[model samples]
Target: MRGLKDKVAIITGGIGDLGYATAKRLFEEGCKVALFDLKQSDAGLAKAIDALYIQVDISNEEAVKLACERVENELGPAQVLVNTAATFIFKGVDATEEDWQKINSVNIVGTSFVTRYTVPQMIKKGGGSIINFSSVSGFVGQRNFATYNATKFAIRGLTKCWAYDLAEHGIRVNTLCPGYIYTSAFVNSCKVLNLDIEEENKRASEMHLLNRQGQPEEVAAAAAFLASDDSSFITGSDLLVDGGYLAK
Candidate 1:
């Protein structure tokens, strides 16, 4: 919790469950918050938290650059950056080149573009924290998940490299890998695939030792720790908030 007060923080995909939770936590910890997404956030939510919302397509370098600049101008140089914007595409070896491109552009390249622009601001403020979201998929393969898993794995890889590259500048980079979190996205995906929500939920819940899926706020707590000085000694590591899912 230390080192979080008065810091400027940015959360990409801020309208999403996990991202929104993280933003709320950071804001509560006295950090000025900014949310970035491809679409505008609900006015009530943004106003409730007294945070700024910026519509941005992270895959577009120009859009990312402008958004970062705008944040700096409005909220001050960002000292914490959480990259949560991603595209999800579940496919196997049969995945088309287009599938790969669509997922990679957002999950990988988009993450990089946001980080690329935010680093300078962090450097200006004498260092910062960067939390990149990965998933249990990053550590293990799943059936029909080649497309999505690849990007998650790459996120961890990028986090490690960025940790080393930015350490001298006082920036710490780490990956937040969560297990199956009960989110709107999860239920919606089940609907899209014509799977029973209850059945799918049971399947996912059983995958973790806790016998339940995680909540967005639970994951948000981990992100807050990483964002604060409490995790100053940790970097280039994979922090699993997976409900002991990996223990098995």
Candidate 2:
């Protein structure tokens, strides 16, 4: 809540369910928000939140570089970066080279590209917060999630290393690991798989101690705390927004 007003915050995958919720929260806290995604953002949604949107493929370093420059010139140097952009590729031991490339390009390399360009801007501001989105998968293994979970685990690794590397710059880095949330992604996956939505939801709910899935806003709230001065004393840590899913 404190030390967030007037600060510039950049959120990758900003149009996604979780990322959008975070942008809304940061905007409400008086941060000038910028949304970067692979596709064009809805004008109405951008206008509603009064945030800037740029279409970018984070895997392409050149594009990421340009977008970062544009954001700095327009919204000012970013003091906070939320790396929520990711590609989901669920595969097991049968995963091929292509599968590995697709997931790694966006989930790992792409995240690095975005951070590469954004870090200098943060330095200009004397320091900043970098929120890297990992997941419960990062902490544990899952069925048919080898490709995806590998990247999530790598995200946590990157956060820890970045925290150490960037600490002297006054920047803080941390991973935001969340449990299953009832998002459009969940519904769409159910539809695509022809699974009963209610049954699937219930199945996911039972995995958490709370007996329910988490919400985007709840995760957003945690992100805001990390972005705000309230988390000044925290860094190089994994903040779990899970519903005690890993407790068991």
Top model by TM-score, which number? Answer: 2
Give TM-scores for every candidate, taking all chains together and pairing residue i with residue i. Answer: 0.98, 0.99
Candidate 2, residue 223: lDDT: 99
Show the lowest summed lDDT stretch of 10 residues, model 1: 39-48
Tens-digit lDDT string for candidate 1 (1-248): 89899999999999998999999999999999999998678899888788899999999999999999999999999999999988888999999999988999999999999999999999999999999999999999899999999999999999999998999999999999999999999999999899999999999999999999999999999999999999999999999999999999
| Cα lDDT of model 2 by residue, 1-248, tens digit | 99999999999999999999999999999999999998788799888889999999999999999999999999999999999999999999999999999999999999999999999999998999999999999999899999999999999999999999999999999999999999999999999999999999999999999999999999999999999999999999999999999998
**Model 2: clashing residue pairs?**
none
Task: Report the alpha-carbon TM-score of model 2 versus the true structure.
Answer: 0.99
Please give the range of 10 consecutive residues that has the lowest summed lDDT in model 2.
Answer: 39-48
